[model samples]
Target: MSNEPDRAWWKEASVYQVYPRSFNDSDGDGIGDLQGIRNRVDYFDELGVDVVWLCPVYDSPNVDMGYDIRDYRSVMDEMGTMGDWEGLLDDVHDRGMKLVMDLVVNHTSDEHEWFQQSRDPDGEKDDWYIWREGDPDEPPNNWISLFGGPAWTYDEGREAWYLHLFDEKQPDLNWENPDVREAIYDMMNFWLEKGIDGFRMDAISCISKPHGLPDADTGEDWFDMDLYFNGPRIHEFMQEMAAETYENYDVMLIGETPGADPEEAKKYYDDGVDMVVHFDHMDVTYGPGGKWSPDYVGMETLASAGDDALDEMLNTMDLADLQEAIRYWDEGVGDEWNCLYMGSHDQTRAVSRFGDAHDYHRESATLVATFLLTQRATPFLYQGDEIGMTNADWDREDIRDVEARGQVDILMEEHDVPYETIAPFVRNRSRDNARTPMQWDDSEHAGFTDGDPWIQVNDDYERINAERAMADPDSIFHYYRRLLDLRSESEVLVYGDTEYVLPDETYPNVWAHRRTLGDEAVLVVLNWQDEPRDVSGVEGVESPVLFGNYEQRDGTTLQPYEARICDLG
Candidate 1:
């Protein structure tokens, strides 16, 4: 028998996520299409990414920005036709890169044919969605929607209330129905036959619900997610889907599981998915009020505050908590895999969230890139993060995300909070931050569109853009390129065991770890603060610095937001 352990291509490959609507608008329609993405395949090749996870481009009203999918096989008219999508696939494959489409199977747009049929009282597809009959004055249960309303929406036609965990435009599919599972499996097979490499399963864990749709025991008004998130039948559904589709093809499966822990994730891995994206590490800095409250401090505050101010902020920060979360997965997952990322379509920009987006933009951006790339898990680079994109400076009127607008309405109507009080928090944590147009150049609309862009381009595009970064050898773009190259070439980085040299609690601002594969080992040291700090607790100090943000390093200290990778072999 061969002694070598089995490995998959996705385990070692790096993925780049492209939010389709904001990537580029080639037709001057202010909306990015498949042709626009096809035009940018060369950029992906140059960046050295192995896979591109394209966000949803399916036919929809865009109520949740394409998450409310109207059709499974058809492309959106604004995005392009099936022909254009095929051409984009060819272009991606031609460049030696693979493309992964977003698989949104948890819910379907209310306008979807299946949903419309299911809404009919005597239709054959009546059981295709979750429906219950109850008093019109009150919902079936006390469950609240994720978008800040009642989860159940009454359908006058069927005289029933349909469950919608998200927007009312999106009705949750009844996975318990064998016919629904078969239909979803057929859709997956259709795409797999279309030549795409894999799928980035969106909200995969939310497919299952508790045995009884009971009211949650919570002190707050909002429904507790524990009743539905990763509930009773998650593993069964995933296993069935995997056995019917993913297992038959040589494709990657990445599940976006928000509430899944290391143990729960291992179950999914055993069922069939290749990797899971957990969100515990990302929630460290969230205050007691969660993501919507104004009590949490923003990244801009951390970057500009003084030592005393920073100390107070550090108390509220979750550096140690984040480190523990990563370590737990690294140890608990065993041979299974996990995905590493600093930002995504649903979150703020990585550079603006974890790195300094102000004076030390370049250094801090590169530091975060290096930290993520050197980890043992597969790293995903969000769109424009390679060029150090910052969050959009959007005003109240500029915001277009449905979730944000709903939250604002809830705060005003229910809590009696003034609009001004919550506007700052909305700006700091809105999904719109990562939904702005890509800054390709310093053109009228940052070279993203020839005509009017859908969202306003960042004003700093003149100083921070792909054109300038590609021209400069020391830019964040080139740093990311080099980091990807290093990961591709280093076996230790791809499959090594990670060991923390300085735990987060001991030195909260400094994240230091060592990755070891047999006799070969590499040390990664990153300073999360804005001030210089002495590096300690690491045994091997005489190793050569393989990569660093600063040109000159004293070997014993790291400059503000400095990142260093040293080969200890």
Candidate 2:
């Protein structure tokens, strides 16, 4: 609603997302905690990030790896006590950085006190969750949970069924209940009053559901996401929430919207959140079957792979579609805001997913960093991404993510999918890929923990650890540092209008874009191939190189996986 220029710290700041369980294990319990994060505040300071977003550390059963909240006010026992979290916040502030907590309000763990009381038919919190009287053998609707089975679970105690959009252990709360909304709002205020900066709202758009809970039109047994995502009262609830909490404090609010397009995202901003982390751009490589059937370079292609096949894999990504999505959000939101990120706790490693992580690791890593950092939106760097970390080579036995494991079971049981048929996709697209312990050094357990890591560390830690990166001037860590510095120093990079130069179909291996603010502009050219390519846009122009991955480059020729930023003043 406000088309004014954004001067807020969040708009200009770079966010570093740290998954606590995998970040670093300070207490050596094989799990990263608040103390671990506090111990590494200097690393964030050195990276020059303005904010650190810690994923859910709230009390949970770890059924869904912290997404299922048991207690909103208390920290997880494995993560540390509330005092440890407070100490971490103080350390981040002392290092001149802000900390944002992941707010998971979509559902609560079944073990939560509210849900426990709701289980009692005559209890005070009986209506706190969505409960319906239905046949004990049948669910109220044909809706399926996001994790895999029937959405409604029949509770023998109450002789009714409760709706759970995710895992059965995580029950969806009834937002229609005024007391529930008030409780959530009070929780928000509690964290705000505790000196935390803001919240990265988890699955926020899916909080509201249709009035009658009607069956989806998709004909499939599973609930259609469209039926519930950004429901009728979504904006009303968001506005009410903002009026109650966000409006009263100077803080940032970023909602994680799975199916939100630019227009829907604009609505979220209008309702008072700063921005929404939309997934359109990240899903460019998804095949017809979605994440389970991602279109990746085949083994045969890799065996006989030339520069062309490599280019085809990297360049064929619907970059043009990604650009359109970015432009749509920028134009649709006016001055609200948008988040630019290539990876997160739920997705695969960015360098491994988008860039050539094997052969041209450093070049591809910096290339992706350069492209993301120069964008108009606030850039988010996932932990371990700064040092070019890749996905862990895990077998089926090593899988830890509930969604991944559940999907595997569903595929095998329902779809007749063989282990070999689904394992490859799971290996490439599993959230566990990003959940591996942070590779801090080349020492045992990647220096993440003294004890055995909860998950296997990537074997390439010797070459990709942060310790080596910090010591090497030409490392990805330093490149990220320089990119962050550019954003800090140049106002154009922070608030510039984007202009895509080369279309994806025309120049499949090249992505060229210009960011301009008045007369000042920055041109970013990325060659996503494994072989040299000719760059043709800035011919005969006199623009000094602002940043580049490779050391030497002729004005027109680009090396393999090369990335360059030129100041077109």
Candidate 3:
């Protein structure tokens, strides 16, 4: 007999994002497949997640690690067949967990039939992609590609340049064309009918472009995403898509909106999109030069540096800025819900980026887990995060990610930068850090595959694998389970209002927030730094600890990277 509004299932559920290429390989092909995922349903149940979001497994050239998809209805040869996918879906459903597929509608591979047909200027599908006439040298405008070059690639067959916001092989779809939108909607419906619970739309903000492709107003050094990200027709297209495909079914929708602020995010929410993955908090470390500047850790490549060098790079990030960015979204979302995450395929490992991955890996990893789960939003836990996975210690020769390789090629080939000078920077920030094969056991290749892994496994796999974590009571994986259990059992954690404990104070190392429901409340205190912090000013330190990273605690003193969820008595 409560008066609270009825909420959707997604609002009360936690998501686990599985990057298929690195999750598990059942066929010994050194690549993760649908069968491998089907083989791990019990693990998902053990982890206590409600939804499993699979990254792209569609047919692809893998120029951008499956983002450059070649076919909408077909499965990748390496990722197994449509039969395997259907079987996997059935297995997930049998476990009472929902499966959400990654939706990549902004673009298609240059090898896609539509793009191939559009390559012919006189063909009926000529307008399927954005094509224009311009000087080959000028590239239609000064717009820089996200992969580090001109956005336009010249096509000899069409005698014109086609726009590719990512790698040249991934052509941006012309959503301005109604036929193109219809085709995408039909493909989505095909999957919806096949029993997917939802979709995690990839780079969805880039779908709508201005009427005319214009030159970037910014300089040539960085990306000019402002010109097209969350463009004019974005809301219209999203609404049309919802009506065409999602309106008929009860499903969740998560849009990956880059460069969107709180105000922009509300537009998607208003358009019936369930939630959005905004990058404001993720990009807090970027300086005026954005991701390419030395202010960011990934841009600093120390050729033979030690842990001290890495520590110095990590210190460039400001905790106050992080708090401000997080607070901006947390407060700005208003009645609309938010999606929370610490790491993903496109990001460096969360421990390496935001916590001390080397010295206090366990403490920092658990601390981040508490922060992610205790918030008033749906948490999406990336694969390998449960076992406290850290970034791979990679060198230039070990690089495989398309974006990292593109940066290296640009620095060394175009700018004559030394390989040694930029190699470490790329390693520290490579997307491959998160894409490393899952650490399942202490055996060869971390038991991800009997064959050689597509990417190198982390050297610390012997200590961080899942088998070891499951057996140890104090392991990071267990802490995640306990946190999820706490969330599932407490209504306040899921439906309460969050209020920062020390709003006007200057305590940079401490993050204290209270989640309060009608008659229940809990306080989450976290020390974000690797030093002892004075949280005595917070009145609830003496209260009984509901859950914590440390086994024992003393009054008012929080150890380095310590976290506590205390009942506010």
CA-only RMSD, every prediction: 3.0, 2.9, 2.1
Candidate 1 Cα errors over 4 Å, as ranges: 1-5, 296-316, 414-417, 504-506
- Candidate 3 global lDDT: 0.86
Which segments of candidate 2 are over 4 A away from where they belong?
1-5, 219-223, 294-316, 414-417, 537-542
Question: Against the hidden reference, what TM-scores do the models get?
Answer: 0.95, 0.94, 0.96
Work out how many backbone clashes candidate 3 has.
Answer: 1
> What does candidate 3 score on TM?
0.96
**Counting only residues 3 or more apart in sequence or on different chains, how many pairs clash (N, Cα, C under 3 Å) in candidate 2?**
0
Relative to the unseen true structure, what is the C-alpha lDDT of residue 22 in candidate 3, on a scale of 0 to 100? 93
Tens digits of lDDT, candidate 3, 1-569: 13263477898899999999999999998999889988888999998999999999999999888999999899999999999999989988998989999999999999999999998888999999999886766678777778777788999898889998888999999999999999999999999999899999999999998767777778644766678698889999999999999878888999999878888999998887898998877876555555544434443344455655754574356766777777888889787888999999998888877788878999999999999999988999999999999887677888988888877777676545677766555656678889999999999999999898998999999988999999999999999998999998888888788887743356767888998887788999999888998787887876889999999787789999999999985
Instruction: Give the TM-score ranking, best first.
Output: 3, 1, 2
Of the pair 2 and 3, which is ahead by TM-score? 3
Off by over 4 Å in 3: 1-6, 219-221, 295-305, 413-417, 502-506
Identify the leading candidate in terms of lDDT: 3
